[model samples]
Target: MIETPASIVADRKSVYGLRTYISLFSSAGIGCYGFKLEGFQCIASVELLEKRLKIQRYNNKCTLDSGYICGDMTQEETHNAILREYDLWHNAFGIKELDVLIATPPCQGMSVANHKKGNELKRNSLVVESITMVKRLKPRFFIFENVRAFLRSICTDVDGVDKSIESAIDSNLSGDYNILYKVVNFKDYGCPSSRTRTLVIGVRKDQLEVTPYDIFPDKQPEKTLRETIGHL
Candidate 1:
């Protein structure tokens, strides 16, 4: 299960029994974070911009045509369209399972620099679009990534009650997923840059054995820019 994703485009001999992934807010398929890698087969991807979709297609070295959708994920039509895609797969494969959902919604609403003194912008609530998809698709695991400020950003729920973004996710997904999150500096993981962000993961309660702590990668020795990219 720790294997890197073998190309799903290859014969089933390589990717058989692997998890299926659907990416939301996917931009050019490069910032997939980790969902489109080994052990996971990216079955579908959605982006708001058509240009990004083209970039994704052009840069796609991985297998699978990657069913792509261009639309606002927060809309009902988008949800219905994705559901229809899943329905078609189920009818053809005889099993209904979308193993993982990864979403990195726009961070303007939750960025610390955006509002130094005011409440978090309502725009941050777009994460709820992903939460709704989880409720509908019932994926075994979900990945939510955003700026570190997302942990403190607040939003209004259907009841109009003020809630932190974390609370909103918990309120929506805790029923099925045991959510966990950590603020990580990717540089510690050997990335050349010092990009820090909040990574939230949800493992379905039934999959308790794969805890949140287990999902994140261990910190590797730091690599300086010279060692990482000086040659370039």
Candidate 2:
């Protein structure tokens, strides 16, 4: 069934008291929809394309106009805009910290399905922008999602040194956060179709009660391709 913005908003009426979150590279709101459904209130979301942002807005991913940002993640202006929205949330909610940050950077360069996979693909470096935000905003929990090869992919770090994406994340955040990286099939986690992806989860050091292992869900019964899409 297709879900309308009104339906989503009505169903999520109780979410105002839940943990607040923000999204980066939130293309059409697909990646963050699960978070929203789980009662995480998305206060701000950024997408580079206006068309995609329009879809997100229609879905009510962020109800506030200031929270729906459409701009280049690599640009300083875009970063400032996101930060401004974060500040607004702090003031509106009377809180100094964000609950969660969900970022799914473009995976074309890191995906095995891409025939043109190489360091020449500038999109691969966009993960650095996500990492930069973690440093600046310091959300209590952060999630980075991408293709299974994300950690193995090479990208220039904040220090301008070529390093694996895993190393860059560790070098930048391991000190302040307890992080874990895992590769899993979405089918094993109750998704209808099979999808292999990498997930990097980080919990701020101060959030000692919850570890990455506690956040990652246990495996579920696998679903077959035919079982998932046979009707179509």
lDDT of 1 by residue, 108-175 (tens): 77775665545445677777788788888998889988888877787765456778888888888888
TM-score of 1: 0.84
Candidate 2 segments exceeding 4 Å error = 1-18, 118-121, 223-232
For every candidate, C-alpha RMSD to the true structure in Å: 4.6, 4.8
Task: Indicate the residue-level lDDT of 217 in model 1.
Answer: 79
Best by TM-score: 2
Task: Give the C-alpha miss distance for residue 19 in model 2, angstroms.
Answer: 1.5
Please count the clashing residue pairs in each candidate, in the order shown.
3, 0
Q: For each candidate in the order shown, give its overall lDDT on alpha carbons.
A: 0.75, 0.85
Question: Tens-digit lDDT track for model 2 on 1-118?
Answer: 2233343355435545446788999999988898877767677899988999889878877846678898899999999998988776666554568889999999898877889755
Error of 1 at 36 (Å): 3.0
Q: In terms of lDDT, which candidate is strongest?
A: 2
